[model samples]
Target: MTYIAEQERYDKMTYNRSGKSGLRLPAISLGLWHNFGGINVLENQRAMARRAFDLGITHFDLANNYGPPPGSAEENFGTLLKQDLAPYRDELIISTKAGYYMWPGPYGEWGSKKNLVASLNQSLTRMGLDYVDIFYHHRPDPNTPLEETMSALDLIVRQGKALYVGLSNYSAEQTREASRILKSLGTPCLIHQPSYSMLNRWIEDGLQDVLDEEGIGSIAFSPLAGGMLTDRYLNGIAPDSRAAGPSVFMKPEQVTEERLAKVRKLDELAKSRGQKMSQLALAWVLRGGRVTSALIGASKVSQIEDAVGALAALEFTGEELALIEGILQG
Candidate 1:
């Protein structure tokens, strides 16, 4: 069956500027970092994608190493694109990144011109797209010179493989340097992707300041702290949860009693405000309008609906903000 996008899709989401660029992304974007892998059912992934677009989530974030076997997520997404999203391509913002360990050899990863270029070509092939809206360097390459990496990004935009370029997992200093080089090359760096959540406030240390000063947009990954901010773990970690899975990033031990206590307190605060814990957490990230989007991952369509519901209650009062801070401090 052909998938027709909802006519009222644009009415719901709040689209914000991607830095000083002309691009605008939704307040909440869908991330294919998990569950769109080879292990997951293709039909289920299709349903999630449709529901997201139907709900006005125009951006779908992906990376070269997103799947369990690397590249499988793009393969799966390619199928979805061919089947459902081809007609609505121009209405969506599709982005992907490279720079992680994708293949065995050294050229398979990092910030080399050869790696970034070649990896994008493979990504395009797998995703069945002529070009991606945004292409990113997945992480900082300590061995590669900033000039080299930034130059490659400029080249990508000039070559028409990507419309705009972004940096992920980059520090304040690194983002500043990279933006400088890209600006010198006549291609401004548009955005930065970072791990940001109530539990992980590393962005506040310096990164956020750099973004604001440089006029670069920020999209927060793990905005729900890898599902920890939600009510899913208010009781305990379900066996099927990310913390219980074979994830190297999420661990069972991290779901300690202390964390659960904090989550419960926050959950209580959310209930008092007529919102869910997840909704409170998502809105908190976008509270100040600093972040352009909260990139969320989901396995089921219900989770997508749940995250999108956050937009309805994005406002936060001084009292609620103080209570949230108190809970975090406790």
Candidate 2:
């Protein structure tokens, strides 16, 4: 069948402004952190991207080192971009980051000026793009001076390599410091990406307050807690799920008996609300206005559709919140 988008795609999902910026991103943004690797089938990755865009998931997130082999996911995504989505570039909010290990030697990783600049250039080359909608420092480097890292981000924006700057995996305190340094250089930090989910409340410890105070948007990564918030492990670990695999982010040991019990209670609550566990999880995160978008990763088109469908019924009652907290606390 020839590819055709749903006619009512845009009308289905809600869009929110990123902080105070003129740009607005979809409530759910697709991340190329998994399933778009070099070892994966090309047709599957292409189909996934096509399906995501067709479903109004306009933002696609990538990084310098996403593939199992590193750097291959961006190359693969670039091929898809040129072949299918090139004509609709203006409609897409593409983002890439640096700060992780990418290449050999000391120049390939971290938050130094040399590493950030070189990494982005390599990322652009792999992505086959002149400029990304947003470029991010993937993580904070204690050894690197904040001024030097912010300077690199400033130069990238001024050089037209990226339209906006972002920071990821930064603490509330570090975010404030980075924001100050970036602002001093006249480059306002636009967004902050952090791993946030119902089970993980690290961001709430103070990160959200910092972002709100600084007027920076937040795009939450792993909002589903690497699929644990879903029904995949409520009964037990599914062989094909992340919890059953050797994932870097979510480990099998982390899903203890106690955690599974909490998940089962949450799953029951979801059924009571007439929604799936995954749907409830995504909705819970998006219900808060602080989140600009939920950065999600899916291996199949159906998964994407299922996640997007939750946007329609995102409201939660005070009692529901209280019950959820009770379950989480227990």
- Give the Cα lDDT of each candidate: 0.93, 0.90
TM-score of each: 0.98, 0.97
What C-alpha lDDT does candidate 1 achieve relative to the native structure?
A: 0.93
RMSD of each: 0.9, 1.3
Model 1 weakest 10-residue run by lDDT: 240-249
lDDT per residue (tens digit) for residues 1-330 in model 1: 889999998997789998888989999999999889998899999999999999999999999999866899999999999999999999989999999989888799999999999999999999999999999999999999989999999999999999999999999999999999999999998899999999999999999999999999999999988889998798899987779888876799989999899999999988987889999899999998999999999989999898888899888889989988998988
lDDT tens digits, residue span 1-330, model 2: 445556776876789998877889899999999889998988989888988888889999999999867998999999998888887899899999999988889888999999999999998999899999999999999899988999999999999999999999999999999999888888899999999888988898999999999989999999889888888888788888777777887888888899889989998999998889999999888876889999999888888988888887888899999999999898
lDDT for model 2 comes to 0.90
For model 1, the stretches where C-alpha displacement exceeds 4 angstroms are none
